[model samples]
Target: MTDALSQIRRIVSARTPEAVWHELAAALKPFGFDRILYGATSNRREGSVGDIQDVVSFTTIARHPGRGREDMSFFIRTPMFRWVMNNSGASSWRWAEEQFAKGLLTPDEVAARDLARKSGLCAGYVISFEEPGSRRAAALSMIAAPDQTQDSIDAMWAEKGDEIIILAQTMHLKIQSMPLKVHRRALSPRQREALEWVAEGKTSQDIAIIMGISPGMVEKHLRLARECLDVDTTAQAVAKAAMFNHLYANPTGEPKR
Candidate 1:
């Protein structure tokens, strides 16, 4: 109990995703999970968690070239992703086996399952974080050591499931509050400033006045910002930048200078 609280403190104090991930990995290591994958996205819709490119994810597993770790699209094709999208809480990997036995798995899911087994990832646990707004989905997959069986993991869960869930939830909330980095090109300070002013309901000319720049330059900044965020309009730029936490904070989770 004391150790859990201390680990949560370390996780909360972490300023960067790498720092937090290290803290989380260390905290879960003793529980038999040797590797972990954590992913969250705010761009999801019904029955889908959106694209992996837009998700803010961190993994402890070594990402080898051409493996599923490098190509996260592999995860999206798995039945576990479907389960996390539809449910909450922890689930034993055997649930997928049962579904497969009942012929409930899709072809892609079957392929992913078979691939996982070949890769020595047949036993593990997954936790689906609850979505309060329904516009987002987050989950963590913890892969137990190869020597650990599903029955052993289940027994461990029976005793420490709540503790694991609490740790994962704490880490999730911390990660959410931290600055997010998406696959899009980062907006420049000028671009971020322009969008921030626009979010404050300022026009291009107004932003130019506040930023001490010409209106045409302001328009140029806004245009570049839109392009960087891959949005069609300045309004969409603001929303997308804000959605990824790029408008208010930097990668270090500190105020933009």
Candidate 2:
């Protein structure tokens, strides 16, 4: 626990999320995992499942040379991602193979597996972090080094799976604490107030009357909030703002909810 905490502190001490990701990847390398892909979304819902573009937030840290290109395609095609979508907890590449052998792999899933194999990513573990009663969830993949065989990777996991899970969990929580670019944009006071009221089920007219502002003014502020959040509707803006902790921000600028 002491060593794990120390590693987590080092990773979190990084000045930026990108730096934190790099530190985390380095920490996992000694465990035979040389590549990593970590992504999270606070907007998970029935409509958003299996749609990469609907992820409200995402981040990836990988040592693979083709990581940038791969990231773009993997989410839509990966069997591991499909598994994470339906289940919560840790799983390994062997689990994916079992699914494949069961004839559960779709065409895209087959393509994703072939791509990973071609890239020398033959063994890895995937961990899903899902908070109770929250739409937010995250997934982490720790891929074995190219030179490592499946047997060696499996042996390592059998020996240190608990430690690896702890490390990945620590990294996930630390990443959540760090500010993401999408979350850094602060809403104007009025914009936040409007969204907060909306969260309480207040309509624009209701909010305007409560705030002693004209209905037109309330609508204008809501529109600006939507634009700022890069969403098309008030509901989406409210959801997006909530993801950034803007709707119920405390005096210390942290989300109360």
Candidate 3:
């Protein structure tokens, strides 16, 4: 157990999201776990709790064949997840307290309970780490055989809080590294203007009316922005650009457009 803890700490300390995922898989395998999933959301309103705001994974024991390499679908549809989200606060400590209060379970054990009884996971755990300087919170979940007990879970937290915190911090840092700042090279003056309006939540037609451009032109520029960001959908493109500071308007502004 000490060696596993050391390895997990080293993996997270590497400061690379990819490395963390690889190491997480290896470190968790000893406990009979097969797969792991992670997700984050700065604001619950932009999407919803349990939605994959960001993701990373490994598949040594658990084989999610046909599932895309970076897929994030598990979170959205898992059973009892809604309950977990509604009950669990968006912080690791909050969830931990609730778990301990409810069943002498630590946060990890509570998470494991959901995985086992509700999410088809035999033995599993989930921990939420709220990102610093941002409202965004990241959730890390692992699935294994249904044998981990509350004592074991609590012991892991007691002994390895520092290592787990490192993993959580690394995850948050990677999310930040993909900042949504606007890139001048990626958008023309007109396109930039259009996106700013979109970020403000204006429809293409609305933007066209506001900017005196044809609706077709408005659509064209938005499409281009999506392509530039390599995102399949316009909302995703807008989010990427906005996070990178390229979007024109602040969605989190007052009045909540």
Best by lDDT: 1
TM-scores of all candidate predictions against the true structure:
0.92, 0.72, 0.48
lDDT of 1 by residue, 121-193 (tens): 8889999999888788888999999889999999999999999999999899987877676666778899999
Q: What are the per-residue Cα lDDT tens digits for candidate 2 across 18-84?
A: 6677777777889888777777777667624323443423334344443533473465468888778
Task: Report RMSD (Å) for each prediction in the order shown.
Answer: 2.5, 5.1, 10.3
Encode model 3's per-residue lDDT on 23-126: one tens digit a residue.
Answer: 76666566544566655554454335322322223233336542422334544444334434444322222344364466665454566446545645544455
Superposed by TM-score, candidate 3 places the C-alpha of residue 97 at a distance from the truth, in angstroms, of: 14
Residue 196 of candidate 1: its Cα lDDT?
93
Residue 249 of model 1: what lDDT? Answer: 77
* Candidate 1 backbone overlaps, count: 0
In model 3, state the lDDT of residue 111. Answer: 60
Stretches of candidate 2 off by over 4 Å are: 46-73, 182-222, 232-236, 246-257
